[model samples]
Target: MLLPLSMLIVAPVWADEHPGQAQLVQEVAKDTGKDPAALNALLDGAKKQQSILDAISRPAEAKPWSEYRPIFITPARIDEGIRFYRDHRALLEKIGAQYGVAPEYIVAILGVETFYGRNTGNYKVLDALVTLGLYYPPRATFFRGELKTLLELPDNMLAGPLDTLTGSYAGAQGWGQFMPDSIRDYGVDEDGDGRIDLQNSLPDIFASVANYFAKHGWVKGGPVAARAQPDAAAKPLTVKDSAPQWPVEQLEAWGYGPLQHLDPGALSSMQTFQGASGSEYWFTFQNFYVITRYNRSPMYAMAVHQLAQAIAEGVNSPESATQ
Candidate 1:
């Protein structure tokens, strides 16, 4: 399931003292030019459910590399990754060249997000988005904006209310787990079939992933991360929310330096991951930050990177050797 983005922030909710969810449904209807009464009716049963609101307002989990690394790089996942690449080789290559991102990275993201479109989710998107937008107080504004976007989508884009119900928890739908707004903004009809279908269209999904990376400042042919060794006298640095805030020069001044094999001119940020036994250091480049845009977790970014590498290596290896 696509995890709720609200997990990044949490706030309290007061139902009785507020304008009530009825007003929210009306607002969405008004904004989208749909009938207010119809929208209100659609939300009648949905508004009463508090469990969805409760789920959206919870804090996100922050796991160390020690635990996160193993979850994504499993043998089963690697095998699937190889199959994904082989199946979509042509489309992957075309999209990769167009966007200047590696095919493996795109494959890894799809593998991680929806298991190559095998498990998009079972939640109703309208129910999830409306529940979060109206009842979840912390990130209500963000989700409400998403709700407005969902309502603005052309009637044809939706698979009717019934088919649209099945998606991720946070209302991210289709292969790449794009939120409704993202689908509108970044999705592409790569197959030239006159429709953007991330659910069943491999070309659209591939293009959307590439488009997302390009928009997020993905540097073509750039290294994602490089091994780094800090001097014995250097103090460990802390990262809040897996963001790359520190510059490469600052990291070098602090006694941590990138590996000799990496280019000196690369723009890099210091990253320290807590392993089970000790700390692991690396210099993350722009491509690394691009992965974080999908999910703002260093562990997630690294897992995707490693999985992509594993997939590429596995694909090139002898078939008998891999088996």
Candidate 2:
């Protein structure tokens, strides 16, 4: 029997280009309650995006702190943090109270993560997540989890079409570079408009950030970090746990004490930073570890802390907010 041309259906060339991705579509669809065909179609549309893999392999945080600090702790970023705090002062304060995180940490998270929403990246979040989810093996487990989170988002949770969604190469989205999973778990609709818009909602962004920190156990009144004058013969240390492995009194017995006054028994993680000046020994408190929970890097936490401090100084001085 001869069928009309309209009866013919063509298979998409992009479909099943990577067999594992097809399997992923099935798995994510099953887990997230999305239609398999719709999920497969979405996965098929995501380009390989080798650039994402490349970018992930060489994250700036991999650099020594000496080099990494300057990238984020610029004078301009401090000024921006001050200005950002000033602009969103009320919301930051309100959210800070609600979440028990300080306003400066929220501002610093935004300033460090996306320059206060000025550069949230141009790569499609869908592409970055899907590419890493399907192809990148080393971090595939983490990316796959984030992908599922994105898949499970209610239609109203998204800012726009998935294809148009864009963020960092690593698939971190919004003004705060939250991974997809964090978006769902910590995102807030501060405006009470009934939708969480991480892309355009500054109130939501600040709240989400504060919520993340609070959930991570950010100590409201605890010291974050302090400069330590370690004995010349003292060996460096690498952090292994969130709690301080070394107590302050013990470190002092070893000739390392806070240059600033603090409780002698305060538990802390010791880390060495390669500064432009020289190697500096430091003791990081519970709040510092809380910041590290955001990125799992000592360098990142220090940079954010240092930047926040600078911004705080600028805010108090009002003269250094010149930029």
Candidate 3:
């Protein structure tokens, strides 16, 4: 879900004139009562721009199943996944059962975001947020708000200003890729140690992730999506900005039928993805939409869904006993 901010730097804009930058400093001072002098000093010499502008400005890679599939469901990833599950099976199972989110889905998220704790970013979160908030005009307002929230974070939760400045290029830090606001709001002290250290604690990371999904209205035992067939007479459904709409009965009335059995009252949204066999269709439900909230891409959501299913199924397979 992290969009590269380097793409926005080449638009001939200067960092000093953003209205939100001043507002953010004021808001931070007002909200956290922190001495702005220290923060100002920190910001004064920070890099004003990213050097990766040309790298980010390139057109986004379209839905390339062949290319994207390997990133999430590789054999090595799956193997490491098995170990992750075994190591944290107790906590993961408890959280998954409580949140109605599959442990595999949570594992896939960790895998996707940080390679299961192997590559948790090298940029300081403070510097990244400050740079993007002041210079990235296309999303300056959003990043500015995040920067204000970052400043308001408890000192105990933060890396020293320098350490926080070096984590993710866009300011998302920790194992779950939480922005500072999300960290403050959704983090949980799963270890019962009175602290939530997402960067190094697996228990805290998994629990925080479950807490996030629960807050986002993840339904227990709800269907994420199902394959379906649309009648030739049915008018094509237009996908606008990846929002899910339409119920099962309405879709049927419009010439869509479930490829697998589905209840008439089930909520659904028509979704199409390019596959090697051609275009594939599915009726996505609320849980699927929840996945999109984590990353606003259907491909990303679908990848998580499929990888989760694969991991769960692989664990339960008869051949799994031999391993």
Tell me how many clashing residue pairs each candidate has.
0, 0, 7
Q: Which ten-residue region of model 1 has the weakest summed lDDT?
A: 8-17
Where is model 1 more than 4 Å wrong at Cα? 1-31, 45-60, 159-163, 235-250, 318-323
Compute the lDDT of residue 249 as modeled in candidate 1. 72
lDDT of 1 by residue, 47-85 (tens): 324556665555233566887787777898889999879
lDDT of 3 by residue, 12-111 (tens): 3223655555566677788888776766655554555464323234423363765666677788777777777767778899989877777887898888
Local distance difference test, candidate 2: 0.81
What is the descending lDDT order? 2, 1, 3
Considering summed lDDT, which 10 consecutive residues are worst modelled in model 2? 4-13
Writing each residue's lDDT as its tens digit, candidate 2 over 1-323 gives 87444223222226546666666667777777789888777766776666677778898988988899989999889878988887777888888899888788889988999999999987878878877877799988888788877877877677777778899988888899988778888888887888888899888888889888988888887899998898777655656754677788878877786899978888887788788898888888989998988998889999899988887777767474554
Spell out the clash pairs found in candidate 3.
123-166, 123-167, 124-165, 124-166, 124-167, 125-164, 125-165
TM-scores for all predictions: 0.84, 0.90, 0.86
* Candidate 2 total steric clashes: 0
Top-scoring candidate (TM-score): 2
Residue 72 lDDT (model 3): 76
- lDDT against the true structure, per candidate, is 0.76, 0.81, 0.73
